[model samples]
Target: MTALPLTALPTARPDGCPFDPPRELAALRAGHPVSRMTYPDGHEGWLVTGYGPVRAVLADPRFSSRYELMHFPIPGGPEGTLPPAPVGDMTGIDAPEHTRYRRLLAGRFTARRMRLLTERVEEITAEHLEAMAHGGTETDLVTAFAQPVPALVICELLGVPFADRETFQRHVHTLMSLDVSPEDRVAAVTGMHRYMLDLVCTKRAAPTDDLLGDLTASDLTDEELAGLGGFLLGAGLDTTANMLAHGTFALLTHPEQLAALRADPDLAESAAEELMRYLSVAHTMVRVALEDVELDGRTIKAGETVTLSVEAANRDPERFADPDTLDIRRKATGQLGFGHGIHQCLGAQLARVEMCVALPALVRRFPALRLAVPAAEVPLRTGMNVYGVHRLPVALA
Candidate 1:
């Protein structure tokens, strides 16, 4: 058997198709589902690109999600050994440690809770739509509609004051931005943590009707609550915001899909799912092997980092029919848009509610919505952790 060459991680999306995963990643998935990876730090690891392998790795407990354990894939990403993830950041921990935080917060985001928020999400969606309509024909949809809807929803859920939202949003943008210097990134994160810490302090003094308030009843300390609030805030804001922005961009570019979605408003739910699958905003994740694991007839030795390309997995031909094409009606079941296993997104249901309500509302409200700028001129977040458009200028006729 020919040895599969060691491939570098692909960070660039192919020109003219910003919604699609990098062509290099697609080819890698097709040729070798599990291949050798050479991290920029010169560490040898494995890259799992296929749907099956990516899902398998995510499900296996032997794979560690610790920040201090896994090798960073991107060039100039934190080099050398890193510190352990702070309390309440579930993404950086494994197993029992993760379980504690997940258990404490899971109830807050349960199906019932998310359903209760449905009315609020609808109201929020409508409010944003109304604002966009009033803003005139030519406006950046990202700011006018996409970003605010989710940001406001998350703010309400976390009990953040409406007055602090602009500052909070600014901090989030800085932290998530890829072009910012390390010092600026640190400062942004520090600012957010400080804000969250203050909020946690207030919640401790007097609990309210929000997620943070609900958690204050638990035995968790003030610091832990602050960390958890920050984690949830960042997660809830960036992922769904990008999904709304990029998904709208995808629909606008593919008029047929947008038209079908607009015509059959009942298709909103499925359309949201298809859009999630088609434009996976949270594109990649990393896990480290804690034990020797046999995968696809190859052994991934313990301590080796594995990069799961969620974008590639979602687009795997074997997983979904006509995977590359955006079909609002396609039953996009088993997609990794929210990831898999114990680490699956806790806010998945909330995100779904937001998208199902927001997208359809925008389309129905503005039947003649179209891009103000040329498709090529629409700026994309090619460098951010979440894939999305930097700004979507649209004319809501």
Candidate 2:
């Protein structure tokens, strides 16, 4: 088969449309779900935009998630590129090595275990909502509520001191940001590793009742433990925080949907799923083919990168009816928001718990919640890997 024209990824969303995937991505998926695209660095690769193909590729063992194997799909030079994930960062490692860490940690994040954290999540949500109620009539939800709720939850689960949140959060911000210098990114990563190393050592001496402490029973070394701790901390913090902030923005802007959720608190679970599907923040992921493999009739050669547009896939019309619409009542099962397959998000349930507890609690607490600024003026985190707002100023009228 002749290859599709090699074009750059269509990453630009329509002006003023925050909840939708990039317009070009949707168009591309509709026509050529798998098409050749040139990365910013000028490497030609495949872009999978369809729901089935994206999910299939994510599940396929032939596709490699190793960081060193992928080419950056987004534009920018050396600064935009990230080196391979460090030792114990499970996201970058393939099976066996990846399976080892995953096995030790997966037991800790089981549905039953996560459900056990519901009461604690409720407490955290209530505390933040209460603080917001009295702190001011108007404030940035991202800072005061969205960011901190999950931040605190992760602290409790990881046994990290909540007081030192600013230290880790700032470092995480550096690590996730596209604007920072390599030096600063390295510094943030190094700083986090050092902090986690000290904590891991402490945990080794006297285990606490937390995820890291639980892992001490495993044969992981101090360096590996430190890396995993930092990795887990960074993973837990930013993604869900953005989801809350972005989900709130999505709900408030769509009044009927917001009203549906507010009128029925029981809608929280589906509402969180709908929000995740609607705002696919961790929009794009890459997987390089390990060898020649047939996918949807096309052969993806080994070492050629395939950018999986899960954001576009989530909105695929075939899989989702009126996929662009935000309907909280819709049963959003199989949404690729947390992704699919072996490398699916480790903390997906915890994130779901955070979103389900925090987003609805936020709305219920401030029945009169609204955007303090015009929706247009609210800043978007377009530059970062995580899609969300920088500040979601809201009036708890």
Model 1 per-residue lDDT at 373: 85
Each model's C-alpha lDDT? 0.87, 0.88
Residue 242 deviation, candidate 2, in Å? Answer: 0.6
For all predicted structures, in order, the TM-scores are 0.97, 0.97
Worst 10 residues of 1 by lDDT: 1-10
lDDT of 1: 0.87
Q: What does candidate 1's lDDT look like per residue over 1-397, in tens digits?
A: 3436664688888888888898889888888888899887888898888999999988999998998997778776666545578667889998787898888888888989898999999998898888778877788988888888998999898888867878878887886766677788778777888889998998889989988898898888888888888888888888998899888989999999899988898998899899989998889999998989999878999999899999999999999988999999999989998999999999999999999999988888999989998999998887787889889999888
For model 2, the run of ten residues with the poorest summed lDDT? 74-83
Clash-forming residue pairs, model 1: none
